[model samples]
Target: SDIFGEIFGGGRGGRSTVFRGADLRYNLEISLEQAAHGFDTKLRIPAMATCESCKGSGARPGTAPTTCPSCRGAGQVRVSQGPFSIAQTCPRCHGSGSIIPHPCAQCAGSGRIKLQKTLSVKIPSGVDEGDRVRLSGEGEPGVNGGPPGDLYVQVHIKPHPVFTRDHDDLHCEMPVSITSAALGGEIAIPTLDGSAKIRVPAETQSGKTFRLKGKGIKGVRSQAPGDLFCHVVVETPVNLTERQRQILREFDAISQQDSARHNPRAKGWFDKVKEFFES
Candidate 1:
């Protein structure tokens, strides 16, 4: 009959034990555009793998681990500390309850080796800064036929130069010439894909924003693309020739006389300031 005894090494009716390994973590940096879209990346990392020479058993190739005689295969030793009797790990077997007579030379009985490993990971779309991606069973190898640990890859997205991104939308400055802004003309605007034409309405003021539908980043939660906000910045003419400067001076003079027609906002602000000064 298979009847169990005290089970503390009594009649040898206990279950066999195994060893497990430790987990690992890594960090990765990607571009902001890459985060908007999913990407495949590879990383090189240093990890501990099981020794092949002894098949991770730590004993020599042909020899198996034998029960430790020092602790009688119990993996612990009784220590009487003053008024207490404490059971601590056996020094001979390191609490494994077994000893390798002929240890493997490669890992020196540590059962693992330090080596560089390359792992490929797939980054999902809409992953933001400080996001973590878990890779199962890709950490340190298991010990003594145990299950391996997990690998955590922390992600970071680099800042973009031209665009500022929120959750799904993008904001950027679009420079339009003074002539084009006032007279109403088509100007080239920069986008993620390429340059596109956006019409500047007549009398368009600086700091005004225009939205381009379906032109921003696409989020995983919402397939509906975000809008791209183009903030208007009226750029003054530069590197003007003598004739161009004269023409601009004449234009400025003509536009300055009639404030209501040309510069209504500025004229209204100045009129308020004059009224305050008079009061």
Candidate 2:
């Protein structure tokens, strides 16, 4: 049996036709702050659109298409092979069940042409890296009377410099001068918005974390802003002059006279070690 033939073995033709189209994809990159806050961008895409000259009819100017003679108006043809009788697509009409003797010059017989379209896309807040922003009905145009496909926009966020972000909290290292750590003073700390001063207590130790409330990123779903954690790193004295070195040595000598008074923990630990040896 042939692919196309006269329906009911009479005038040429068939039943209904099936048409499908193609889909499109795009990649978009945004900043971390933009992803956290949300923004809109424009996208230019190349796709196929229905031919204007033929208005998607695919017929020549001033000429109309004729119903397929092989499949009548149905689009499918029935054939008998050996002991089997089955339905096949009509070749003459290519399942469209119509024929244009004088096809449109612009699109030939396809009914669509290449074009470029610019579209605006909106980005939602709190969308992290590798997130996808979908735009429905924004892909390539459909084929021969079929529905159009979809467009997908994949998102990527750039890295920040000063602060490191976790889920919502921001982490940063803050250096404190030796005097600030020992005698206690105000030290400036960095935040997303601006610099802030934190009071350092006397004898403050290194690796202590100070939290600033409402200073970190605020997600779209969060009720309150996340916290900013500042880890203190005590800075040692450098470029000491001869007089400064002598003063430091005298201070150390005074503290060493009574270890039990200046360094009670060290004296207690040594006593415990001696007792352990005797036992």
Candidate 3:
């Protein structure tokens, strides 16, 4: 049935005379901060618009199109062979059912012209990458009398330098001095809003994660703000002076006197290694 319809130049009900326009797609890039907070921007698009000189009729000014003589305005022609009747588009009118005796000079009988259009776009908050924003009736102009198609704007978020985002949560690695990690202290950390302080417990180990509540992004559908996780990384001292080296050596000697109390993790690993070797 579909093949017959194609050969006859007719669809399920009949041949459609109206022409529908094609949809347009555009990719828009925005910053992560802008994605967190909504913003408005303008975009330029290259598309097709109906010709003004001919009023989309493809005919010259003050002249009207005439019905195609081949199909008698039916836009299709039929051929009979034996017991079969094959119908196809009228070659003279090319399925338009009319012929422009004097074509429009502007669009050269195409009924449309290329144009550059400027449009304003509004991005909603918490819009993630690959999200699409639709603008109704903003695509290429329709042919004949059909309505215009829609425009789709795809979203792309730029990478952030200081932090990595996961949905609404945020993660960052904070470097701390070895002494600070051992003795415990307060350190200033960066947040989306501003700088905040986090307290490190005494004997805090490297790679410990501290959660800062309500410091992350507040998504569009979220009831409460997400959390910011700071992963502590103990930094080893480098480029020590003569006096600092001597003091560290003395401190190391004092620490070795009670390895179990000062470095319980190292002592436990050594005990495990000894047991593995004996076994």
Candidate 4:
């Protein structure tokens, strides 16, 4: 039976004659910070492993398998009807050329069992969404002494609260009060590392973008750090007190007295509208 099993290129009911292990994939979700900076994490996955009790032989203790007699250890049998001969796998041994008389109780003659495995994965810096980390030989157990498949860990970055990423650059909106826009001042802005001060120029209008060099994320393939763009948005005062409202009204009256100097953009826009209407 041993010689016949060797001749048939099949193990003695220990391994599969034809099938290889299947690869596995797992999705790992991480924060934007973790994606920007490398992180180490552990994953618990359910997978197939070789049965310890059977030792991947599919036979009970102290027992051995015998070659199939149905196909004379050939793994396949021939059927003839009139003019043609059809070759088919022997149903008794399922083309393994061997049969396990006493099956292992743990794996139920499958030579493998489902188990939970723990694997540590390292996520590199600047890994974006859909990037995969391959762990070699960490997948399902192979059959017929073949090599195990690989495990792929897919990355998914969570949405950031303040910044939006574009390649290596970061963009965010900074809200400035009306007073800060009117009178130049320094305001603290958030960055990846920490907060930085940005100068708000006098009479700075809304939608003005300011770039901070080397304040963005550094990619894995990038030579230098990217910049951070801060778009200034002038916020209108809300919930104003009666005294503040009166003061604003007085200021508005004064501002209207010198509209060309105080509000040149508004005056120019009005002039353009007046010209268009007259023409």
Scored by lDDT, the top model is 4
Per candidate, the number of residue pairs that clash is 0, 13, 0, 0
Model 3, C-alpha of 254: deviation from truth (Å): 2.4
RMSD of each: 4.4, 6.2, 3.3, 4.7
Off by over 4 Å in 4: 1-19, 270-279
How do the residues 1-279 of candidate 1 rate in per-residue lDDT, one tens digit apiece?
113223222233111466466778898989877887789989899988888887788877888888888777877766666755566667887777788898888888777888999999999887777888999998888755778898999988888888998878989998888988889899888887687789899989899899999888787677787889999999988899999999988988998888688989988999999999999
Estimate the overall C-alpha local distance difference test score of candidate 4: 0.86
Compute the lDDT of residue 123 as modeled in candidate 3: 90
lDDT of each: 0.81, 0.78, 0.85, 0.86
Once all C-alphas are superposed, what RMSD does model 3 give against the true structure?
A: 3.3
1-279, model 2: which lDDT tens digit per residue? 343333334333232333555667788888767876788888988878889999888898788888888878667676777665666767888677789999999999677888889989998876666767778877766655667778888887677776777767889888888778889999888776779988989888789999999888777567777899999999989999999999989988998899788768778999999999999
Candidate 1: pairs in clash? none
Worst 10 residues of 4 by lDDT: 7-16
lDDT (10s digit) by residue, model 3, range 32-86: 7888778999999998999999998888889988888787777777777676667
lDDT at residue 236 of model 3 (Cα atoms): 93
Score residue 140 of candidate 4 by CA lDDT: 84
Q: What is the TM-score of each candidate against the true structure?
A: 0.83, 0.65, 0.86, 0.86
Deviation in Å, model 1, residue 235 alpha carbon: 1.3
lDDT of 4 by residue, 35-104 (tens): 8888999999999999999888889877877778887776776666455555667788877778899999
Q: What's the ranking of the predictions by lDDT, best on top?
A: 4, 3, 1, 2
Residue-level lDDT for 278 in candidate 1: 100
